[model samples]
Target: MFKPLWVRSLFIAFTALFLAAPLMAEDVNLSERAPSFWKAEGQDNTVWLFGSVHVLTEDHYPLADKVEEAFEQSAYLVVETDVVNVDPQAQQQLMINAGMLRDGQTLEDVLGEARWERARSLAADNGYDLEQMAMLRPWLIALVLSVTELERMGYTAAHGVETYFLERAEREQKSIVELETLQFQISLFSDMDRDTEVAFLMQTLEEIQDLEAQMEMLVAAWESGELDKLEETMLADFADYPEVYERVVTRRNHNWMNDLTRFLDEGQQDYFVAVGALHMVGEEGVINLLREAGYRVERQ
Candidate 1:
């Protein structure tokens, strides 16, 4: 049997929360982005890799002192995307164009009756109609549902780590670079099959009730700088969605690894690269990849 949508939603929620907690506090004595930063001998630049959560609440405040210090010392700030200057209207247009299915491809046609009804009922509770969302792909629906739930829970992208740092970078007159484009990220969702999309949504919805507990554990692990624990949780949650893992984590990690090396070799300028925390964990994580490439990675 496939997992419920709520369960999958909870996993996504927990994952987002886990990545965001590191940016909430401003304690100078504590380390925030660990196993995320790497130092290279005989190189004039320092590379600070930070894992970020995409949404956050007011309760998650005062980013860790180390993160702030890293930002202050760095000359450039790198993010997954340059959302700071992105046009909202254009973004919405992109999402709608990418998420909605072609004419005649309805959710019912893809999801069938039993699951479709459940999905409809869940959407109704959130002020959306099933029929209206029927043309949207499953991954798109998953994103909409996840964002809606986080918003209801008082988390917003406006308060997220990436946005916060982007804002800071702009104010400090620091140059900002993106590892990927929003369109590229959106394309990842477009490539998912209907079944995987439905399964992802169903699993997310089933985990809604346990989001708080999961968040607590994720935050604790991240704060403790336990990369292995973080990697384990991600691997388990993402096992059902290999495509997502490949698109969002693995492939991107490799791309960034190449970019990091190039940046060090060519510019010799210090860069603060902040990406989703999940990318920095696991065997193929950017940390290990960098280490394998002969760069020294440290937890501080």
Candidate 2:
């Protein structure tokens, strides 16, 4: 269902945004603007890149005037994936196919004794029951717990950047495009090797405890465009897990580069691209990737 697949997917996107360090002039006056948005100039067409916070408080809008203007000027809206308007049956099938454990294997078997105990303790402390949650892969359980914690805090994907723009796009009858499919996004977690998945799950469990504070920090960083803390969070969080960082952040940017550049180079109309902010961060981020490919990607 959209409930399960996009709940996890939305959490993943928000988590990824925590890793983004925007490329903008340092110490810009927040009163003037924020730097989480950009514009790429190609020979013919233009692409407006807005780094999205996947979850936000309802008062977080109306967005900045520049972002609104960019959307108004564009002919198409592009997002990482369409979590809305999905087939519930197909999404549930994908979840079942990718998230379930095989015969004779258990969560404890995969996580080993100490990690399993840590997982169980954390889940129980957070009001989850491991026995009832058994048989799913560790990564899926991690995401499930993360989504639950977020919901408990009253955040919903209905207030997310993608959803906001998506609803407006629909109302305006503007075309919408997806950079990836729901299945591919799921495989980013599900296709990881066992150890990688366990490590990811463990880190997620440890981090969710301070989620509220971390979330406020995320919003503060977004508004101020000061990224020292987020850069630190990004490195400390993913530097040890190069594979996880690659799959979740860098590699996906590279994959999206193909679609992004095509839109820039050959599209019949201009586009507005809204992606997780983290995919636009770091040296290997999509904004830099576009610049390296010879487009002049400027902060908006």
Candidate 3:
């Protein structure tokens, strides 16, 4: 039914860590450690920006009451993607397409022996075989690897903020707009080099041991809404993998910023914009960039 039990478990653990720490100092600034919700009140429009952790557990969510209220008050819900109403078959197809590698390539050829062996060990620990994941794209592999590790630790997408909002939007008939398409998101991964992909996978495997502790600190900071700490920790970790960081984080932030401006200008409706928390921090973050663009962004 699920990808695998271990994969599911890893997502659960990962989500739990994110929810447990609402705020922490190790990876974020104390002031920014608060919730990533902001409101830009204007004479004609009110925009609420929410920093969101994509995946979580049911027990950790609904967010705060204020968050729910914000949603209720908003005229529209804007998400990174409109996964809420995506066709089941289309979504599955996207995942399957994202997982496939180019015809000639194999995981072993790309990862080499030591790394491949480590991947095999990781697979075994998670109750699967490395070969099973061989044809998966590097980016998809990275996502799967991350989700699997978190699942082993106990995080689940079932409880993720995005998933929750998606459910709510469906029930309430709220209008939902996608900031980007799944195809665009998937293309980011397809653009990466084979070596970079292999390196990312290997690095992720190596980090598995410290994943819990690191995630704990990150989660605490995130829950507390400490943007600075979260930014610092995430950036430091990102520096270790520039390829993945550039593709997944940096580029996407830029793209989202462009969409935000267009959305604000055209929609003319109150919106609750929920995106990954990480995208809302750092110099290149949406919040900071929005401020630079002359929009007054205040924490709510």
* Best-matching candidate per lDDT: 2
- What range of 10 consecutive residues in model 3 has the weakest lDDT sum? 1-10
Candidate 3 lDDT tens digits, 1-300: 011212211221111112233423365443333467887654467778887766654435446667778899887888777666779899779878766867788877777787788888976775667787787765567667677766665555666667788778888888888887777765655666776656556666656566667666656666766667776766665565665555666677788777676656565677888877777777887888878887778887
- Model 2: how far residue 172 lies from native, Å: 0.6
lDDT of candidate 3 at residue 266, scale 0 to 100: 62
Q: Please, what is the TM-score per model?
A: 0.85, 0.87, 0.82
Residue 88's lDDT in candidate 2:
84
Q: List clashing residue pairs in candidate 2.
A: none
C-alpha RMSD of candidate 3? 5.9
lDDT of predicted model 3: 0.64
What does candidate 3 score on TM?
0.82
Per-residue lDDT over 94-172 for candidate 2, one digit per residue giving the tens place of the 0 to 100 score: 9888999998789988888998898899877877888776798987887777667766775667777888999999999
The candidates, ranked best first by lDDT, are 2, 1, 3
Candidate order (TM-score): 2, 1, 3
- Point out the higher-scoring one by TM-score: 2 or 3: 2
Best by TM-score: 2
Q: In candidate 2, what residue range of length 10 has the lowest lDDT sum?
A: 1-10
